[model samples]
Target: MNDTATPLLDVRDLCVRYETSGASSWRRHLTTVLRDVTFRIGAGETYGLVGESGSGKSTTGRAILRLADIGGGAITFDGQDVATMGRRTPLAYRRDVQAVYQDPGASLNPRHHVGRAVTDALRRHGLGSAAERRARAEEVFVQVGLTADHLTRYPSEMSGGQLQRVAIARALVLNPRLIVCDEAVSALDLSTQSQIINLLMDVQEQTGVSYLFITHDLGVVRHVSHRVGVLRAGELVEQGETKALFEAPLHEYTRSLIAASPASHPQGRDERRAARQARRRAGVGAA
Candidate 1:
């Protein structure tokens, strides 16, 4: 939120391409998944990437985390070009920029106990000895609203929400500065989703971490984001302060996205939002 400070993550003109088979039997060509996408997540700020399914939101997250190839552009984090980070610095980068994936079930190793999986990353980073790391892992469990004792349990034993809590705990164990939460609560029930959202806010509050929250749910973005960027067909159509964008959308694509959202003001849509904006303007007029 500091105005004079540099951004925590800056991505410029990023592009990604995925190869798909052609109709003709023996041919393939690259399909662009993200097209000249650019954005920034500031220190201790939540930047929401809003879009529908297959809008390349996930691809952007994967590319930022180095899980996918970057066919073009540059991503810089903490003043270092992440793409140029060699073998010696990758582990360090991984420690600073962590990810909470969409499917916790698939992301977590089924064979490992939840506690072990969380601790493995901490140990790999050489944060602590066995005893210290175990204790740290337990502390993170309670931080994410999970009992320390559940560390012994395997991923297969937990529900989707619980598995996500474990995943969160794992990410927290490393004490990351920035986290890419990719549909982290999409699989949970509404009540459970609220719990996770609160947990993420609390974690950000206490740890001074920022989140790149990618979701198709505008309602969720409205609740959690400081600023929102709408992506359509691999390109960012519009972005601004969340309230400003919600109240007065300049782009038709953004308005369409707001319309498509299920939880948006259903019947009145633009009318209600416009009324609120009018009131604010009238209040300023009086002042």
Candidate 2:
């Protein structure tokens, strides 16, 4: 963990609800997506949120980014309440917090050059003149392992890894203090996933930025996160320092997630499988 007295992002008893139509337009019900979920991320640290599909992992990220409505509790970033920021989110807040989603291709527009993603953000925040924006875009591209020539290419022209790099570049161009990376590397191959993970860690080392890395990959979480929180059915089931939590998970759900994650090596695959079977037979099913 960061060991800092004050965390960069603090989420306290956070609750999120969504209004869904029932049988008809007049019949609607509010579903609680997140319940009293609480966690903290220190500056320059990575906090991994892990869960299976429909476990509220992405919903929590959306709440932090102010894309989802908060039914109760609070999200404090840099000591400011995000939910109370009013209907119009401040430009400074937009500049301070950014997101990198799972599908980079969908997040980008195919009609415009990939460089436009970064340049448009700069233009929105009034960061610099056109010339400066282009220059800055080129700078961030290089920072993310892409060359200036990439600025002229459209999304269709680049590979998956390249598109993801562009997405990271777009988030980095703003010089945000915190990044909400929702399944950022889940779509890539193992090799490319490792590369992007290292790239993110390197960027954090250099820039002192924090990351809310939300993913179901326990292996990735162990490799990158300083601390981790396990979410199950819209609630936090376990949370602690990465090493301690993984080695000695107090919650049965956490143990199941760790067991379900494919081992990095195949040496003890059978033994691990047998153990999992035994656990399941003993009434501790995998989550």
Best by lDDT: 2
The all-Cα superposition gives candidate 1 an RMSD in Å to the true structure of 7.0
Report the lDDT tens digits of candidate 1 across residue range 1-287: 45477999999999999989999879999999999998888988999998988999999998888888888999999888976654345787889888897788886778888899888988898888999999999999998888988999988888888999989988888889999999888888887887788688768878889999999889888878888899999999998988899989999989988887777423122343466578788784311
Error of 2 at 270 (Å): 28
Estimate candidate 1's alpha-carbon lDDT, on a 0 to 1 scale.
0.85
On residues 264-286, what C-alpha lDDT tens digit does candidate 2 reach at each position? 42212234446668889999973
Q: Which one is best on TM-score?
A: 2
lDDT of all predictions, in order shown? Answer: 0.85, 0.90
Task: List the candidate 1 regions with Cα displacement exceeding 4 Å.
Answer: 1-4, 86-89, 264-287
